[model samples]
Target: MTLLDGQVWTSDIYVDGWRPGRGEPWQVREPATGNIIGRVGTATTEDVAEAAAKAAKAQHAWQNTPYDERAAVLRRAGDLWNVHSGEVQEWLIREAGSIGPKAGLETHIAAQECFEAAALPSHPMGDVLPSTEPRWSMARRRPVGVVSVIAPFNFPLILSIRSVAPALALGNAVLLKPDPRTAVCGGVTLMRVFEEAGLPPGLLQMLPGGADIGQALVTTPEVRVVSFTGSTAAGQAVGELAGKHLKRAHLELGGNNALIVLPGADLERATSAGAFGSFMHQGQICMTTGRHLVHESMHDAYVEALASTASHLPVGDPHRGEVALGPIIDEKQVARIHRIVKSTVEAGARLAAGGTFEGPFYRPTVLAQMEPSMPAYTEEVFGPVAPVVPFSSHEEAIGLARRSEYGLSLGILGDVGTAMEIADSVPSGIVHINEQTVADEANVPFGGVGASGTGSRFGGPTANIEAFTETQWLTARPQIAPYPF
Candidate 1:
């Protein structure tokens, strides 16, 4: 494991393989301290084109590689990650602004994703079809050639690998563009892992850059699929570019997720769920519980209990083991969140607790009496702010929850039958009963609907096959048919 402390960490674009990058370097900083922790090379437009071309060239041989051999690379990468868990965790904390538990969770899920992706080869992809005539027909899953992965800063390692590992397992050459803020961990570290794991050189390319680089990858003719996880606006642009180019896109975008507490809900458990869901990683997660819709019967009590719970959570340096919530990604984000909170208060919402900040660390805040019109209630706060609203009935609660354009995840606390019924009718992709909405399991399909994302999922055992590979139908005739020509 390499120590990055007090050193200017740097990584070049991996074109076909690891090599020195030609473009300028961008300074990567620690969000909490505003210190330059590293410098990562940025890819020029030409660099993205070079990587895509190399990936396209590499895909043919990689796709033809045996399933066992491909799976071995993923397994080796997972093993290597486990060996250096400490460094990975530290890098996540410093580079991505993640707290201790969030950093640990990222590395753990990333390793598990690699292991689960190793099983993609063993899963069923081809099937025999019945035919009426004297002939045979079957369908086979084939690689989509070059895949372009665009990952965000939050949960960089896990989110990037959530798409990268599976695409590689299915025999597609990948071009990964990690967020500039987390380039060291998200790009360079993963490149090292794959290289040491005996993956074929040139099969995985890492190009670290901003929007221009991402645009180049999406528009490149050699690329067949694009897997992206980020803000909804960026996703919309990616989708448009992919659509214009006639390429397959797997997008996991923003979420203004809601958590509803019913009349009979257990107060203690619900408060715990609310606190965890709302303040984890300073509520940076897309699936963070943004809105709390409690039944009018329990609204006041729930808010008080949730505020008391939030007060006990420690907020400070992520490197410290005792800290619960870390800083926002930057001062800009902190200001944005505070502005929303202030405006909501002016518009009649009550700040029950925590509407202030100390540097990058915005205290965990609880807002009550939030109406549907307030920005904090309608939009994604994307910070440690949980806004609670009262609903008179179950139908009203459902209506309020479904009002958002973004439908990614939802949490409901109610009886099994009623909760399940509500879950079925919700417009989100992942729904939880008596639990928080955020999930990081390897065997569950994770994506969103509507403004949250495109209708593409890339996780779990079965879902990866759909996004990285395309199906081809094969027909064979044992005898010649009656010809019309």
Candidate 2:
């Protein structure tokens, strides 16, 4: 059957198989043209309970299945991703408002995530431990029955599958809840991929809904873990609720990342990196460069060059034309971005580039002479807005970077020795020398700290093992020793 079979995308949710959701139907729209692409089902709290129950029941057998069998399923899923890359990229462009390159990147990464997870099943799952008593002792890892993945609209495919694939590969069932706006690409697409790959029924459920559905997933007793990727405020709530329920929560939250341009850096190359980091996917990425810190001696030239680069980049309907950027996810996001720009501009920051928008297409913007207190400087503007600040010394740059509550990603463009030294002082989870903030690899551990996330990094063998499994200590003896009275 084709990837976009009638039952998959048309259905509201996936429980035992594709089915209608109990809640009202949701109309999925293209942000650029404001056109309804399709109407799909929305899940309710009742649906979440039912899906969680099914997942819990399925986990026992899935875990007991041979390790090679589990690994084979993930391998097939990865191959399917590659086989249908074109169709998935189309969905990403139309549903997620991704430009051509961004859409291609998402499809590529989705496949890689599956491929990486395929190796997880065969990895060593435990270690031998020395015991005081004359007994064989070991510590082993086991799946956390059911995982609830709440994925955001931005980079939905990558974020959702990064957790979903690994959890399934490690022998756990998954309940995926994608943001309603981009549910088709994020939720339904995944359901189809694994289904075609021959995943067992009731092992994976896709429930597309809003906050209420998310809450239900967190509180469901069958769900032992919640993998959340979204705003910091929402992540905080998820983390808190999961804690109250005594569940493990893997949160990859928001970031107000910084890109520092030190002395002796190439102006052209620095501006190019800055523009890409701030405007890629309209800067909706969690690791987007929100702040640009340049040495005072080169601040003015850097600002001019960066604004020139931003102004030249194209922004329009990705499906209609070749463009560097696409529309904001919705009008609400557009309004939020404009408000940040207006407030920051009024607070003495100069609008160096674009500060206007039409429809959902906000121009790539650059704000100069920014301070710590400005909204654009402090808030995580999930839009294509870049704020530039100047620092006189490396100490001042480090201080400015550390001023925020976020410690997600940091980028430094300068001498290797100086950049490495500066990186050592920053408390971010990921740091890049002579590179932009937006970077990811399937085999690398990806996450953030402080307000950005819970520090339970995702991806890589070690982090995924820790994120999806629980530790159990076991000991055995030929005979039981008598207890001393």
Candidate 3:
């Protein structure tokens, strides 16, 4: 079925099938103009519980299905992503406030995620174990039955599908709860792809709602695992609730990542890398470079260069024009970003460039002479704001990078030897040498340390297997041995 049909309101939420949500219908608006682009149905907590139950029941047959069949479905889904790229990109641009390139990247990575997951079914499920007794022993990986994937608004398609694709490939049903703002690109689009690719009914359920639905998904007994990607505060709550309910929570949370520029680095190349890392996607990414630690010798030049680049980047409605950056997710997010920038300036940081905004279109901002204790330096400013701080020694840079509670991604621009040495001292889930902080691969283990996540990691074969399946020890004997009564 055609998913977007003239933008008329329809039942968008998927339970057993594409049906109307029991809750109110949400008007999907464009962040650039606040115009109603489309309407999608919203889910209630009761709907979440029912969807979870149905998903759990469907998972039994799915897990027992032939591996080839499962792999075929995943491969087809991957193909479908490319086939529907235009339609998907439209929704992403309108619904998620994504620039053209960012939207395209999401679609590309989504397809790659599916392709990677397609191979998961054929991978070795378990290992042979030695037994002391006279019996054959084995450790087998079994599906967790039902997985609940809670995705954030920023880069919704990639974040949601990375976990959803693998869980389904490994024989687990998934109940996806995307942020209400980007439900179309994040949830409805995915449901349409899997359905068209021959995914059976009840195998993947999309429930777009608010916190009530998310809480229900976590507490529901049918959901065996919770894969969450959002703020650290929200992740901590989900983790705590999942632990209380005896379910595994694979969290990919927030980050105040660092980009260190050493004295030996090429000033132009370093500034370019830092600008891309901080201002990409309006800096809504979890791995965006929040801190710029520059050597005192090159600090002034780096800040000047970065600010010049930021000032030239065009910010506007992506759908209307080809712009370097689009609007923030919503007015609230825009306000939050401005507050952080204003507070940082008040606290003594210098706003080198872009201290102002126009509606939701926050200008790409750069702050210089920043202290580690300032809000802009410490908090995860999920906006196009780069706070540049100077450090005299490599030791000081490493110490500043390690100061944040988050350990998601780190970037170092310098000689190979010096960058690698500094990388060794810093703790981060991802480290980029002479590259930007924001990066991802479909096959790489993606997650973070400390408050960034639970460190369960997502992506790659080993991590996917561990995240979606439970290990069971099995033993067999030629004959049943009787125990003494």
Candidate 4:
């Protein structure tokens, strides 16, 4: 009898207003105790195909509907998100063992995305081209076809609905496949919110299952666009499938972000800023500052200071209402982090601070004297472990930071001159000066490059809506145009 139980969250699959028996149910686990969160209905290959077919069949009416109609449903969906915020908050905490400020972020970010998307105009894509004043020049953004939203486990709510909602706003039907591990907490309830918003049957459906369901959705001809957020390996697979089928795919993948702290930088400011990126979600975010490149002179002092600060970060149950760090997502993740840490130690890395775990909880750990060859430094640990690698020169620090195959995110805390210089040169999508790499406000474009991800997200209303919609250049030929001049 381990910590977790066998029960799971259960939900009826909604297909054309009929609750059908989709074979095989999922056992959603509580990450902390590894107990049953609930058994959500799992979608089979056939179930997925049927759902896609239904969406394709309904696409005509769905896409033709007015933007106001679509916006109303989206706004209503936000209301529903609040209605279920309590339950969702619980799921996020249980699934990710998300603690303190991080746990609440899921609820607020999801609600913000929904509420803001709901307010977007149906036809904001206007027409203009001042360069050619005497000629007809206009641009417009139109709805793409059906989309399959495959989201990752970390920040499940933040990533999943953020992508799907905008697409829905643009009059596109969607089939969202959330990570099976987080189906109950983030996945199923998200769909319930859409349902509560009175979404037209078949306009949006959730298929919560394993890779089989994902493959089914991607390969299905009816799924015209595929938007995914997950590991780089899985992202490559999805991209390949989309390419093979000649379909549009948007991928938000993994990262091994780096944060550089120069000699003259404020140690407290750098440490505090970097802490949120790696500690929040237990460092599961792809854009988190997973690597710390400290100036050689400050290496020892910074490590000692960071270790002391990290040790004091509270650890406990997410529901306890304390500023504590919760466990990683699940048991396997717990073991994976263990192996990475062990391997890093074997490769000559030193554990500077907390590195112990009971159940799924791994106390926030700090590692130093790690080479790029070490797993913890090179690979995406996806845990609260920051590998502090020191660099002698400014050039070397920037070089080490940009040397990765990943260019997802980077940050610099130093003199304004060097920080800005590094921010400009860092080969990442988002760069922060005097701040942590992963601190993305909702209104800015957020994503990565290389193996990191293909798109971005922001905090503002427009930034929020771009994820789900595609740009379509619409033109208007004059009703009565004169002959060529």
Deviation of model 4 at 143, angstroms: 1.2
lDDT of 3 by residue, 47-111 (tens): 99889889988999999999989999999999999999989999899888899999999999999
| Candidate 4 local lDDT, 1-485, one digit each (tens) | 21111222344555665353376766667777777756667778888888888887787797778778878888888776676666667667776567646656777777766776666654466557554434466666556678888888887888887777777777788888888787655566666677678888888887877898899889998877888888999999999988999887778789999989999888887788767767877777888778999999989988888888779997767765575577677778889998999899988989988888888778888998889889998889898898899999988998899878888888888898878887777788887777787765444567778998775653455554455556665445657557788
lDDT of each: 0.87, 0.93, 0.92, 0.77
The digit string of per-residue lDDT tens for model 2 on 1-485 reads 67976555684688888889999988989999999988778999999999999999988999999999998999999998899999889889998999988888888888999999999999999999999999999999999899999999989899889999999999999999998898888888899999999999999999998899999999998999999999999999999999999998999999999999999999999999999999999999999999999999899999999888888999899999999999999999999999999999999999999999999999999999898899999999999999999999999999999989999999999899999989999999999999999999999998999999988569999999999999999999999877988
lDDT of model 3, residue 172? 98
Kindly report which residue stretches of model 3 are placed more than 4 angstroms away from their true locations once superposed.
Answer: 1-3, 6-9
Q: Give per-residue lDDT, candidate 2, residue 440.
A: 93
Task: Give per-model CA RMSD.
Answer: 1.9, 0.9, 1.2, 4.2
Clashing pairs in 2: 12-41
Higher-lDDT candidate of 1 and 2: 2
Clashing pairs in 3: none
TM-score of each: 0.96, 0.99, 0.98, 0.90
Give per-residue lDDT, candidate 1, residue 153: 86
How many clashes (backbone N, Cα, C below 3 Å) per candidate? 1, 1, 0, 13
Residue 286 in model 3: shift from native, Å?
A: 0.3
Better of 2 and 4 by lDDT: 2
Cα lDDT for residue 338, model 3?
A: 96
